[model samples]
Target: MSDYICNWDHCKFEGTKNLAIRHVIITHAPPEKVPYFCTLCSFRATNLKAFERHLTTFRQHILLEKENSQTKEYLQISTESYNVTWGNRNCDLTLKNEKYLYPEPNIVPVLLEINEDYTVYNETIIESTASQTEENNENIEKLKTKHKREMNNLAEYIIRLEKKLSARDQEIFELKRELRCNEPFIQGFNEMWEDQVRDKKEQRDRKREDWRRGKVAKENMEPLGETFSSPPSKKMKSLVKKLF
Candidate 1:
């Protein structure tokens, strides 16, 4: 660290190098004098690095200093710039120049007129902004309501679809159960049909055998009748008599 000059002029207080540096940064660099203002608290800093640190501290102090006049004004300025960049740009030169060279003839009168114009414009803007804000809020509320309705409809549709799917699944499950229950009956019916067919074939075979036996008996009877009807031969008869 380097030796630092006491920010207070005519003060013979020689401090340690670090202490002197801190004093210069806290007192001289602060916004009370200029050339090294802290961006945060607007306090003057002796060095750029110190100003940067002060800015950080100022950010930390934002919530605490929110009600502070200086802090509130700064915040308002920042907010105003954010709201309307074009207007802010147009006013930038006036704000910077008004602080310097105040009593000059042309500049002073022009500055006053410009300030008056800015005030009038700002008032008009505020009035219009209030109405616009109300309209925007109404639109936002309507949008939120519509979104909620749509979400509810979607949820209901999903629930209905789930119920339908459950019903379909139950139907499928029942069909499977019925198929299982009928499997044994179907098998038994097939077995019975086969048995009936076998029985029919056996009956047909028995009828054919009976028809063949009747045909053979008729043929034998005819031959026996013809033989019996014809008389015995004379020689056969004579030989029969001698043997008796």
Candidate 2:
């Protein structure tokens, strides 16, 4: 990399050789300025490339060569000629000329009147904006209050539901406790009733067996008494013959 410095006395631009040359050629010593001169348009340039570019670029500029020593260059830049060539060009020069050189200079007084009107319009806009801002603030405050109230009501409703749930849970707990407390008593009562029923069944079965045995004994005694009565009858007959 070769370091190249600018040769211009006041220019401190420096870079690599190609970059510095381009910078100097393009920026500081442009082609329209120095050693390259165009005899046709009396335009000076630094290089042949610059001269060729200027010739191509400003081909619209007319250079009239007279038989005299001096050549006259005419730039057709007047407003009428620009309108004729470019068609209806609007320029600031015409407005400036109207404002400055006219006998009356109509724009400043009209601008003053507009400024006064704008001041009144701006005040009215500011007053309306202030009123709207105040109204918005009041509406926002009311909405905030409504939101807080609704949130508080929701919280209270939640609390009430929680309390009711707690009460229901307590009721369920008490019912379970009562069932547990009565379970042993209920079991004992059922066992006592079963024992009483078993004892009554055994007593009834013993009374039935005793009644059956008594019936059988009564039937056997009736048959034995008949057999004894036949023996007694023979004895009576023998005694009566002896007496006779």
For candidate 2, write residues 97-177 as lDDT tens digits. 122211212231211000011110111114554566567667877998999999999999999999999999999999999
Residue 202 lDDT, candidate 1, scale 0-100: 94
lDDT score, candidate 1, position 43: 47
TM-score of each: 0.31, 0.28
For each candidate in the order shown, give its overall lDDT on alpha carbons.
0.46, 0.45
lDDT of 1 by residue, 1-244 (tens): 3222332344333344434433433333213333233343334433434433433443343344434343443321211111101112222111221222212122211111011111101111244545665576678779989999999999999999999999999999999999899999989999999999999999999999999999998876757767889999999899999999
RMSD, one per candidate, in order: 19.0, 29.4
Among these predicted structures, which one has the highest lDDT? 1
**Residue 92 in model 2: shift from native, Å?**
17
